[model samples]
Target: MENNKQPQLINPAELFNPEPYGFSHSISVKSPFQMCFISGQSGGEGENHVLTDDFKMQVQNALKNLKIVLQSHSMTFENIVKITLLIVDHNQEKLEIWVAEAKKVWKGTFLPTSTLIPVSQLALPGMLFEIDAIAVK
Candidate 1:
């Protein structure tokens, strides 16, 4: 017989700039399973994929878009083990707000290892945020 239980989620509080520093807190999954690599999703829907040019709105829309992707694969944010966030202008104050909003969606349980990168610009001019994720089921 073999144990088929899911690996315990790893959390590193002081993983040396664990988040917002391009570092991962943990790698929980092993090979040999179906993997989903979601592309960097920006705020908006088809033909209306233009971000609002506002950080908060862009962040909201981006997260909504991510949800759609997750649903398409029959998975939710809980299944996500890793996430990468890209921001056009990274500000600490704005980040605080973003974190608050994230908590609402993530529920502070089963937090996925994440990274946030501050870039000068995204794929679009007005885009303020983009999120990409990887998950296994």
Candidate 2:
């Protein structure tokens, strides 16, 4: 039987609220649908497979790549339940940029739960940002 109960959102008083950043502190989901975990996407294009140097550009391309993956699997942004964002040399400015870009793609649907990680480097060189996602149907 499919569980009809929805996941409860929790934001502890001790922790700061992160709703403005296009995500929540924590979320729970109890569903009977299949869950899809998409691998981290990069910012590369064409035959040369060149990664973008600009942070904003990379952010956009990475999201575009993610969209391709979602569509390929017969899903869309609304199906996403969680996300993990990794940014190189992260800072408040970069975070602001990220949130702006994220808001563009996830303009609606209450924004999915997310986690942001500041990392010094990624698996591939010259990758400014990467995003992985989890979606449930």
Candidate 3:
């Protein structure tokens, strides 16, 4: 089976650089034979399902959880075309942490086109970050 890869990145000179925010202006995909949309994933897990307040921890765990979901769906990071991040109390510091965690997750691999959405709050009170993904194959 051919593993669909990250979409083509589009960054027009007219638009400001989106790299700092860990996203692109747009991404175009050609062959999306199959598509999967995973809902926003949070950092909390296990029986207690206790969410962490640490932004970095939340970013890490959210990506990890997304990985597991993709695996179960027979997809890898390459198959992901886009990722949406919802950050509570978003700021430059949080964006940096998110980019750092993303580098770790997609190390030596093509980074999926991503979007970071700043919001006042999330589903849970303590949740710091939530990530949702769209994959193709």
Candidate 4:
């Protein structure tokens, strides 16, 4: 006789150092859906878009831009399966602030896979951070 038991789903967070294995750093879902890839987004409004010279503000704006892209596809952060963050002048203090801001948006629910990278500089001056996201819908 064959048993018909479903396998337990794995949350990416439960995995250790998922990046080395080319997997998300956290959270995964079992589903058949389409994936969406968003281009790298920076924090700015227009040609004169430099709003705040602060790292925290840049991080916030980057998240806002990410949200806009997701909304355009009728999605939200909950639908995000993977994200890559690029930062210039990376520092622990900045990361801590960024994490705090992210908590406001994510609220410790539906943790998505993510990667953070430190870079020398972004394409634009006065921009401290950029983010790209992949979503399943």
Which digits, one per residue and each the tens of the lDDT, describe model 1 over residues 62-108?
77777766666567888888999887779997788689878978995
TM-score of 3: 0.73
Tell me the spans in candidate 2 whose CA falls farther than 4 Å from its real position.
Answer: 1-31
Tell me model 4's lDDT, rounded to 2 decimals: 0.68
My TM-score estimates for the predictions, one after another, are 0.73, 0.73, 0.73, 0.72
The count of backbone overlaps in candidate 1 is 0
What are the lDDT figures for the candidates, one per model?
0.69, 0.74, 0.73, 0.68
RMSD vs true structure, all candidates: 10.6, 11.9, 11.9, 11.1
Could you tell me how far off, in angstroms, the CA of residue 108 lies in candidate 4 after the best superposition? 4.1
Q: Alpha-carbon error at 107 in model 2, in Å?
A: 1.6
RMSD of 2: 11.9
- TM-score of candidate 4 against the unseen true structure: 0.72
Count clashes in each candidate, considering only residues at least 3 apart in sequence or on different chains: 0, 0, 0, 0
Name the 10 consecutive residues with the lowest summed lDDT in model 4.
6-15
TM-score of 2: 0.73
Q: Which residue pairs in candidate 2 have backbone atoms (N, alpha carbon, C) closer than 3 angstroms, thus clashing?
A: none
lDDT order, best first, reads 2, 3, 1, 4
